[model samples]
Target: MARLAQVTSSRNREVVAGFDNYADAERAVDSLSDKGFPVEHTTISGVGLRLVEDVLGRLTYPKAAGLGAVNGLWIGLLFGVFLALFTTNAVAWFAVILWALLWGAVVGAVAALIWHALSGGRRDFLSASQLIADRYEVLVDPAHAERARELLQTSQS
Candidate 1:
């Protein structure tokens, strides 16, 4: 798309027509040539089809999933702090940190479990637009507008 704008703008003169899609573009060429306007050039791009697998298809989860684990771990640590401050007889804050780590591990494990369930162990992304060339854009010269239309009409009939 970027290239299209760049090329069209730079050329400024010789581009008969620029079509994002293929069908209309081809018709443009057929019609123009029929009208005695020799098609200077034709460019076919992204025509046939596109196959895009979902991201899940490639990875179990996004890297950010690890951030979730880290968050759960932090929460678990906070909970451990609460336990040590109010429930536990141990005066050492280190004990709180250790308990927090244990909880964090449990949280991380739970997260991994949840992710596995979501992905079914087969992380894949959605893919679409296998092929899309239903329409095309046509451009005409300053001189052959009516002739182009006539030619296209005749060709269609």
Candidate 2:
């Protein structure tokens, strides 16, 4: 005999606690898990989201060229290895790899230099962007919501 599995609807899920930050919500969930609560039944949600951009550093021609050259070097090395597999001679394999790496670095550096020069100082800064939330909520299945809240409260005490 095959038994049907139980499915809990979204309506049966409710928010047990709200936190000002994601770490706090995560800690709350961890506490619930430590208390033998089913951690899988819990979920974290961010509310009141905002996009933020943080400047890392100024981007210069030298930096841009260096980045391009490093990327090109790796790509060229990979291509060389792939090409080497098709050749039967050991010397040809080494020759192909050397030539590929040299050309790749030269081409990549030149290309990036040209690109940076063409930008004319319009966008010269490097930055990281992410979406951040003002608050994070811990939600759990209705059956476990009360227990989760109790566990979280006890942990804080």
Candidate 3:
């Protein structure tokens, strides 16, 4: 926790520039780096952060099964690769992997169906959430603030 506090400490830093979006702030930092500024002393802080969730669609049993199947398929493939290493025959190796994948998919689908049924329609939607900020501020240590401002001004001109 001490290390984390040290890393995130902004005690003597001042905002050199502000932007409505992250891209502009990133570009400013890139400019500073290109101009040989001490980029290590700089940090981009997002202001007024909020969580935005976009509902993709309704969650159904079929969609849940499909998602579970894909996840299980990857797990099966990984395990199959490890198990196949023990087999020397080409035919046996292929057969083992194929069987593992099939079993994984069937098991995953059944499990997802059972889980969906148990949910009792309490939560039944698909959505993605993102943390966004109203503005991005580029801050620099007080000691380097003057040089950073000069470089940013020249770059903008």
Candidate 4:
């Protein structure tokens, strides 16, 4: 369980610099930090967001089964180790782990096959999704915005 802290939004923030991408905005903030500016007053925000999905390749039945098996293998190993830790019979540890691994692979393959068949070939490709922005802006508290801009300008020179 991770703890999260929430702070109220400041209304007096001002944008000191804007960049075409996040890397440039990040560098600007880093430069301010290096120049002994109070970087805590700054924030990087993305503008004009877009959702992009890149298709990696086609997903076939064999590929799906292999992916599921790989995932199941790791899970089986974890469960086996946990079970072996509590068991009193030392000699049966290897046997228990091996059994779990074999069953996990078989079950994983069958489950994947069933899921693919149920999908009715709607989505048969692998892809990754990302949210991108057209530009990134570095904002600072109103009081420190001018100093931040000055430090960034000096560093660039």
Candidate 5:
């Protein structure tokens, strides 16, 4: 997996505001843009970050089996359609689709049940992870920093 590079700046850059969230930092830049400040000279940096993992839901036998069946049904439908394209009889096309659907559902259900059993209930939940920054800083070119800061401060007041 690819990771984001750390943000750095030279002495020529100045900090506008240290925000606790990205939205606040983005709003500061938007204010600068509204005031006709050259918004191109700005960048938002996320600092002091940590990865957060959140559990979404539990994976159970019924849920897994249903998911697998749905996926298989779509695949089977596509395969049937592809096969039908090579033939001219309408009756044969329906027959292929029905056969594919029946077999696909049975195969999918059995496969999911076996896979779930193999897990031994070790990991049975869905989770998502994201990198959360403790703070966000809006930086601008030194030449425009003073004006940007002034505009942001006035807007907040």
Candidate 6:
């Protein structure tokens, strides 16, 4: 938190205003420009997401990772075998394996959720990416930053 404060303080001459939607952001910029205030906005991609995906995909999808796709699949297979071997219910090995797969998927989903929550910033978790691919950022001259920020804030509210 202190580090964030430092970085923000360094930009004290600049003011940041967040918008709920793109249209509101656009309106703010248009209004500022009409009032003879310089307003510039930009979008930058997040490379962290791509990097994380590359590493995870290689580890999880590697042919050498497991019997086929996952190194841990064998563990699930073992559990499945145990299920098939035990219990006089007479469950097929295939059914046990399917159950194991479902269990593995659930585990993976939970891990992903935790990871996503830990990773900061606005992100679309739908993608197998860790970082933002696009964002709308604005900049204004120091002298006009206050007015621009106020206008943007009011518009957003």
Cα miss at 118, model 2 (Å)? Answer: 7.2
- Candidates in order have lDDT scores of 0.57, 0.85, 0.90, 0.83, 0.83, 0.51
Best by TM-score: 3
Candidate 5, superposed: residue stretches over 4 Å from native: 1-12, 68-122
- What are the per-residue Cα lDDT tens digits for candidate 6 across 80-121? 777777645545656777788767655555555455445553
Clashes of 2: 0
lDDT of 5: 0.83
List the RMSD of every prediction in angstroms.
Answer: 15.6, 6.2, 1.9, 3.5, 5.3, 16.5
Off by over 4 Å in 3: 1-3
- For model 5, how does the per-residue alpha-carbon lDDT over 1-157 read when each residue is reduced to its tens digit? 1222223443357888999999999988888888898987788888898999999899999988887787788878888788878767889889888878877777787788788889999889878999999999988888888888899989999
TM-score of each: 0.31, 0.63, 0.87, 0.77, 0.57, 0.28
Ranking of predictions according to TM-score: 3, 4, 2, 5, 1, 6
Tens digits of per-residue lDDT, candidate 2, 60-114, equal 9999898789878888898988898888899999999998898778788888888
Count of backbone clashes, every candidate in sequence? 10, 0, 0, 0, 0, 2
What is candidate 3's CA lDDT for residue 151? Answer: 95
lDDT of 1 by residue, 1-157 (tens): 9777645743333344446767666766766666666554333334345564333333335443564567778888878777677644555666777878777866776786576567765534333334455334454444544555566567668
> lDDT at 88 for candidate 4?
75
Q: After superposition, which runs of candidate 2 have C-alpha atoms over 4 Å from their true positions?
A: 1-12, 57-60, 76-104, 110-122
Best by lDDT: 3
